[model samples]
Structures are given as C-alpha cells and as structure tokens.
Target: MSSLALHVADKRPEDPADLTGFYAGLLAVLNDAALNHHGWTGSVVADLGEIGGYVYMKIRPGEGDEPFATIEDLRAFRKRQAEEARRTEEASKQARLI
Candidate 1:
C-alpha cells in the first residue's frame, strides 16, 4: 500500500548515540513532512503496531491525486490511494549505504 524504509542494522541509531530519545529527535524533521504531506502519521501507527521507521512523503507536490470518498470510487481510482496496492508499478527495493 505504501513505500517503506528498512534500517538493516545490529542496533538502532539513537542507542549508539547514547542520548535519550535521540533517534526520535532525528526523526522530527521527517515527522513534520510526513504529518503535512500524508493523511496518516506513521509514528502513531508505529506506536500502535510496535514497529518503527514507517512514513509518508509527498513525491508529487504540484500533482494532486484523484479524490475518492465512496467504496466504489476507491475501487475505481487506483493510481495511488491510502492502503491500496499498485497494479501499474511493481514492488521494488534498492539499498543505499547512506
């Protein structure tokens, strides 16, 4: 339904830094963007689901997606909608050292 960032690591970043809630602080900027651009907040989901690092981003700032309210409307419009799979674009992942 959405893209995810995987942190392949032996430990979480903030733990090594040894500062209280350090990773959360680092994620604040991302949280801001996620809150503004996307309809749902990932950190809240993370808290409920006991997971982390999930978020939403506005890749197309100028382009707006078709709005759908009804269930049939949702079923019809499928370029990108919340929690819906993409038929046009295949799933993929590319790693970076960063």
Candidate 2:
C-alpha cells in the first residue's frame, strides 16, 4: 500500500514529557473521526527540542498507490479551517467585550 505521512513540529524546547500526551490527544481526536478507516498510521516523537518532534499520520491508498488529497478536498479543508478560525476570533472578541 502506498503511504502518505503528515508532520507537526514546534520550535520551542518546552517539556518533552508533554509531547507524547499531546500527540495522544491528537490521536484520540483523529481516531474519533474514524481516520484509521482512511488508512492513516500515526506516530509521535520528541528529541531535545531541536527536532521539535511531531505527530505523523500516514494514509495508504489502495492498489499500493500513494494516497493524496484531491484539490477539492484541500479546498474544503482550507475553507473549514478558515471558518473555524473566524469563529474562534469572533468568540474571543465577544469574550473581551463582556
């Protein structure tokens, strides 16, 4: 099966102990969304803050072809993210107004 991987990185050297738990939280969210059914494999790591470590999810396509997000999917995702950001900003503004 072809595989695709995602990476999350931070440049700060905070607490390494928090990395695994952070990634586990992410995994829980992803798994809750049935991401595993999408052929995703995930992992997390932390090394000296230089690497910043990351949580990686791999997607495998059928027939051993690499999995890729279509342009439509990318666009949809971007739109959703933007919407969420806007909602968050609006909420923050309302909270500040209170």
Task: Indicate which candidate wins on TM-score.
Answer: 2
* TM values, all candidates: 0.24, 0.36
Q: Provide backbone clash counts, one per model.
A: 0, 0
Report model 2's TM-score to 2 decimal places.
0.36
Error (Å) of candidate 1 at residue 62 is 25
In the range 3-97, model 1's lDDT, one tens digit per residue, is 34212112334445543243344344444544455542343212111136432221211124432122232223322343344432333322232
What C-alpha lDDT do the candidate models reach, one value each?
A: 0.32, 0.43
Top-scoring candidate (lDDT):
2
Regions of candidate 1 where Cα sits further than 4 Å from its true position:
1-18, 42-98
Query: Which pairs clash (backbone N, Cα, C closer than 3 Å) in model 1?
Result: none
